[model samples]
Target: MSTTKTYRIILSGGGTGGHIYPAIAIANELKQRFPDAKFLFVGAKDRMEMDKVPQAGYEIEGLWISGIQRELTLKNLSFPFKLISSLFNARKIINRFKPDVVIGTGGFASGPLLQVATSKGIPSLIQEQNSYPGITNKLLSKKANKICVAYDGLERFFPENKIIKTGNPVRQGLLDIDTKRTQAQTFFELDKDKKTLFVLGGSLGARRINELIEKELDFIIGHNMQIIWQCGKLYFDQYKIYNNTKHVQVHAFVNNMDYAYAASDIVISRAGASSVSELCIVGKPVIFIPSPNVAEDHQTKNAMAIVNEKAALLIHESDLEVDFENNFGQLMASAEKQNELSQNIKKLALVNATKQIADEVEKLLKK
Candidate 1:
């Protein structure tokens, strides 16, 4: 009798769409390569992944996990307890699943799961989506078999030998959006005569971006510009009133992101890793406003990577109040500048990220 084992793989990452979507994208690529492979996902209990994973047609297990708050909060006190519980839980899942390979995209759940998988001598990899590695990825780097990174110079945070620059995995639909513009404008009900600006602040939303747009609504319209604003779930109630306004559509979430990217002439977004990658692929003239709330101020670093390449323009959140109008106006009036930014950012697009990362996983299985 011929015998070939069906490969089993474990993927853990969540807490935000930035982490969750990349994990899902990687899993999708892996499924395509190993048609009969058994895939399992581990995410923090109560996180969006618990709901998102099942929707993606993958079975998932949740760890009782969350991150330690930077401030002195009561949640920080329970962090140690949560860590211990998650490690134990991860071990149980590892033992039961006996995965041939384990992968962590980056989140609290990934921390315990990868740590346990590495300790058990299973092959494991981590996908770091930022220019600066997060605390979880940095700590887990010592034992990781491979570290797939989105940016260069992560050797400062991870082992030089394990690091591979695979870039960030973005939705494949964005790879060819030039043909979608007319269809996208029709989809969003946007006037083609007016310039369209896409405002994205991650899945949870950005308070400063929403506020700046709210204050500058008249300014935007006066310049013959329309906006498709993704206000995020948290701020939807506060900003949804603008949905009734002319030339403005405020959404809690943008489900049709491919269409949205196609419809945009300019993009004003937070510098989250996934957003940056998608924007690069969409090849739009972009203005980045990095969130100050992230650990190590990494969003700024992520934005700078592109900005330094002259691929995009950045406005620190603190500078928005003073520079929003002049900077936005100058970009709006200058077609030459817009084309330069679009072409430059497109040059940085890494369309094969998902495939490359999947290839890395396949290598581990062979080893």
Candidate 2:
């Protein structure tokens, strides 16, 4: 908590926004608490974090590391070599940087970095964003001094004593969306009179979600609603044609997520941990389509946590065709349903997650 003590901290996480943004949020909070702190980020080479971390105004070092492929492939063959190389590089970085505390937010890069850090007897903490922990976080949990988690019941994957239910750190920008509603509508050039539907397919995009939206645009528009669709960069080229249509705007990536959340009435989103956290804070009626391609089918578990609370709806990719229209129609037809969901989900928001995680880090720094 002392602004004068210069604490060197290394935050590592990447490969997805779910991993990357939480690290950034934590770092941002810590920086505010310790204005003179020295910060460095470690992420996997060629991963999005290499660019994103620097963009968030921190220096980052990249390790020659990547996650192993689930299926047998040439990539899997090189896993051993990559792991060895990354471990060597992570050691060199740790020795040179001499961080007071290293933090991992769950990513392939965090595996090597945290492994080396813990072996050197340095204090380390990891943040697990999902209800179920990732392989990297699970492995790091053995040696990590603390495990900060967003969901309950994570003690099944982590040491019960080390686990803290601090919730996921959401971006500061998203915390005050209600104040930005009119400004967001103007920023997005949305008609104030029309209700908006926001579609998110995660950072890399979802093929099935895109297909469903493309196929059902008529049905959605027939309800007299406008749309702000983030189709992800991969699918933007294919879905950009919809931008020409009335009452619809398509984007590859939404830089202004606060505006995106504020300008929308209902949301259709993927069930990535970060997205779910943000959606909970945004407090919108949501329909979640969890990706089945993840390591442990964790996205479904994340969505089900909310759906079980009656805070949101879930439509698996397999059931989208049969259930999406009916579910969406009912939601759209009932304003009371929307308000109920919005109010219920809002109750679940852990708005102080970033500060609490920083408080934990401050504890580690003092030790």
Candidate 3:
């Protein structure tokens, strides 16, 4: 309970922003509650977290680790060596830092670090953002003291006693998007009179989603809607030509997502864990185009949870061609449908997830 006790904490996660940002959000919440706490982030080397964690004003260390490929490729051949090296480095880091507790948000780097931390009898917790657990988190669950999760029915994978339905940690900026709607519209230079569609394809981008948006721009605009499309950095060159078109604005990446969400009437997004969590808070009518390329097809599973609740709609990649126009047209034609989706999705939002996860970590620190 003492703020001046100087607790040391280590957060490890990130092959993608889905894993990275949750760890950062938890760290930020913990920092405010314990101002003198020392924080260190552990992430995979050559990953985005190396750059991102530092930008968030924390020190970080990277391990020589990478996830095993699903196929029997050359990358899988290096798995053992990488694992051993990462284990050694993780032990060295834990020994030197002497953290009060360690937390993981599910990534390859977190595997070795949390393994080492638990072996040393350091109290530890892992946060699973998806409804289905990842392989790393599933393995770590045995030794992990607590498991923080976002969805229901995760007990099939994680130990029920260890599970806490803390929901996924969303960035604080997204919590109150309504207040920023007017300012966001001005920031994006969107016409207040036109209905807006916001397209998100994660940070790197989704090729299939980009193709759909490009192919359907004429159809969407015909429905009296404007577009704020985040085609992703990888596909920006291919889609930037649409930037000059009326009723459309394209960006490589959207840095101001709070503003982007605030200004939009409808959303078309890939169903990554963080994106789903943020959308639940933003509470817009969403048509999820979940990526098929992820491990275990988790994105589809993430979208289905909300779809079943009537909180959002789902259109798989293969169905987009045949189903996109009809589904979209129906939603656009009905204001009542949009309001229903918005209200249902908002009911699922856990605005205090960061604080709740941090509360679990604080309990570990106390013990």
Candidate 4:
């Protein structure tokens, strides 16, 4: 007689593409491996995941949750109510779903849901994409079955036995770049003759990155460089006017990032967990401009981890205005620099990370 096992998983994470994308990638891997698995996502009500998760072909439930305001504000008054409401809602979801496993990828919504799941004796796993774990992941570690980390030396935060160094999972398209360069150049309708530069500032875009790129558009082309700039959604309309007579392609988000990465000779972008992970897979020379506005200055730390290894370059937010164009042009002209960064970064690629994590999940499920 043939028998089948049904698995229920409660996946949680969001607040930004950095957290959302990695969670989705893991979910996709889990789905592929376990066709009988039932998956449910827990995200904050007003966040992007409510929309993005559904778009990724998954069902999601929202909690009336948000981060505690760092500064004294009226939202602080709502903090107690939000936490209570989220915990209450989380308990209801856990009771109803009866998830065999809960997975958190570091976001505000993950805090209560994973906590409640652990309290209920459900196996939980956390995929931490950064060098530093956040308060949510840190708090959840004590109860997590296995904590998969991308960056090393995370034992300071989580139990060593509970931790495994499975690197972050990146999007599938980004995993291979061989045939995509010509395809990407044609997709963006960019010229194959000129060296192309792509600028990405994460999903919402970086204000300082956008401002400097907009103001220095002329300087970019004057160096005889073609560009594909992801101006981000908020600045797309405002930056669209510059597309009139330049080799500049502007996008709010590049759906075909594989092609984009293949077509680009140099990248100007932000330093987020997923972005950094994908960049390592792309194995391209990057100039990272981390947003100073993030929590714990983790973006800078993420970028520096690579820069320290001679695998990528970093331009502080303050230094971009004075140094970006000159440095980018110099790097482009220096084939040696590009090769060094490319080869060194490729050494950091976790090509099988998604499947590795899925294997871990299966191991836990079997146990």
Tens-place lDDT digits, model 3, residues 133-200: 77888888999999999988999998999999988998888988999999999999999999999998
Query: Per-residue lDDT tens digits of candidate 4, residues 50-146?
Result: 9999999999999998898777899889888999999999999999989999999878899999989999899989999888777878888988899
Score each candidate by Cα lDDT. 0.92, 0.92, 0.92, 0.88
The sequence of per-residue lDDT tens digits that candidate 1 reaches over residues 226-283 is 9999998889999999989999999998878899999999999999999999899999
Candidate 4: lDDT of 168? 90
lDDT over C-alpha atoms for residue 82 of model 4: 92
Off-target runs (Cα >4 Å) in candidate 3 are 1-3
Q: Which regions of candidate 2 are displaced past 4 Å? A: 1-3
lDDT score for candidate 3 against the true structure: 0.92
Better of 2 and 3 by TM-score: 2
Query: What's the TM-score of every candidate structure?
Result: 0.97, 0.97, 0.96, 0.96
Tens digits of per-residue lDDT for model 2, 95-202: 999999999997889999999999999999999898877777787899999999988888888999998889999999998899999999999999898899999988
Q: In model 2, what is the error at residue 83, expressed in angstroms?
A: 1.1
Candidate 2: C-alpha lDDT: 0.92
Residue 153, candidate 4: C-alpha displacement in angstroms: 1.1
